[model samples]
Target: MPRHDGGEKPQRSCLACRETRDRDRLIRFVLSPQGEVVPDLDAKLPGRGAYTCIDAACLAAAVKQRQFGRAFKREVAVPTPDEMTAQVAKLLLERVMGYIALANKAGKIVAGGSMVGDALKSKNKPGLVLVARDVSEAIGEKIAAQAAGNNVPCRWVLTKDDFGALLGKAPRSAIGIKSSGFVVQLLKTIERYRNFLGEVQ
Candidate 1:
């Protein structure tokens, strides 16, 4: 499809929505050697790729309408709607976790509620505040208020245990990303995740 903005970025039309958008905004799927439809999150699997918006509704529509079959011009093997949704969600979550690990290794993230609160108050405020889903209500509220006061965007996803596992430490209630690049990348993945679940985020 032609670029909607006449820009350099490659665009693909969603097989379900039929709306053209930047390729990155669409999830790419390709046929595996065994003929199963597989999501290529990295867009690197070699084959004619199919596209869909990062949304459960769009995915369902595509599956219901046999859009993938038409796209491939053959009987492409696709999972049931529920299985496909779960598979795509798992892939997106993995990518989010990978970015978290990379950001932590680069020293762009600081964990613990107190540390994150401090970072929000520092001269170099954090680009984003990430709270644990299992955070204590009191501290969670405090940290959220601090992030708001600092005008930092706050997010909630994984639990304290998930944070600890990734950071190689004890459980943490929160973390702050100070690097803009990492913040941008994390938010992009999070947004896709939110869209998939139709969540407010």
Candidate 2:
């Protein structure tokens, strides 16, 4: 008997914005036979997929800089900046929100300081830590130390209010975890480091 299984999803980064957001957080475009840039919202379209962040600013920059050509390694024509940005942003937001819902269902995320602290103390230290800015600096430092000692990455530690609003919920009164904020920050840092690379260049 034949068996069926869902395949693993691969990730790609946006060249223009240098954002390492998940594939879902970015829009995919492919060059059509007519050499027109076509949006591949499903990310299942045939041919090479070039990425751009969902934000209007990043999308505009990507188009202006011909980043799609760099991504596909071929000259291609794209839609108007405003139109493409709107469409891409809408799709990306929906996809990102869906992923968040799935993660919530899987019980992969946690909030609140005391609970998170206990989680860190457990044998299974959390792979990520999200510290709310509202939390005292002393407490934040302590948690950061614990995470560092456990060899876990400290990420997306922002005010609970900010994170909660993004998720369309009442204040979680904590931080965000396994979030794109960490990815964006990491990408920015990498870009800065790369810029200084071979300064002898």
Candidate 3:
């Protein structure tokens, strides 16, 4: 049943944590047409779906307990936890890149060092700043300071080439995620990726 409070998205319980949360905040999995378990990050796969919290701990629990079989009400082939983590990380990275591309098209992103710096100095600061992992420490520090002054989160996880490919430009050293609807989801996705990799607690 839909939420009586009329929440925008329905809630689902994580098979591992058994805690209910907004569906978008949980990662969905489903039995593929070929009878294999697969992550459905976009939630568009046609089949009975199971969900787990985006944390690696939850995923580990799910795998250790063989919860997928119970969730799907059948025997399902479960991948090793490491393999599943890699798959989720890959899908999350793709989702983040897609969000960046969409935000760029929507004029909600500022790419390149000069533009991002200008954005940081402006009164209307970006909500999130991303520095290329390969950027020099000095440059990255400068950008991080600016973002901190603006009370924004600065991330340095993706490579310069990754940002460039997503923005359809030359390799970018820095980028800013301006205020937009994508900011929340993008941040959540990034956090989930970090959590999955045990980078964050």
Best by lDDT: 1
lDDT for each residue of candidate 2 in 1-201, tens digit (9 for 90 to 100): 133347634566776768676676566788999888887866798997887664566667788888888777887878777777766555544544444445455565666666667777787665566566576777778777777777766643335675466556666544324444443443343232222221112
Q: Summarize candidate 1's per-residue lDDT along 1-201 as a digit string, tens digits.
A: 553554678989998889988899889999988878899988999999999998888997898888999999888889988889999998888887888889999998889999998788789988988899888899899999999988899988888998999999999999998866999999989888878888843
Candidate that beats the other on TM-score, 1 or 3, i.e. the better one: 1
Model 2 stretches with alpha carbons more than 4 Å out? 1-27, 31-42, 47-62, 65-97, 132-139, 157-159, 162-170, 173-201
lDDT by residue for model 3 over 123-175, one digit each (tens)? 88898898998999999999899889888898877899999988888999999
Off by over 4 Å in 1: 3-8
TM-score, prediction 2? 0.47
> What is the lDDT of every predicted structure here?
0.88, 0.61, 0.86
Worst 10 residues of 3 by lDDT: 1-10
TM-score-best of 1 and 2: 1
TM-score of each: 0.91, 0.47, 0.82
Relative to the true structure, candidate 3 has a C-alpha RMSD (angstroms) of 2.8
Pairs of residues at least 3 apart in sequence or in different chains that clash in candidate 3? none
| Cα deviation of 67, candidate 1, in Å | 1.8
Model 3, stretches more than 4 Å misplaced? Answer: 1-11
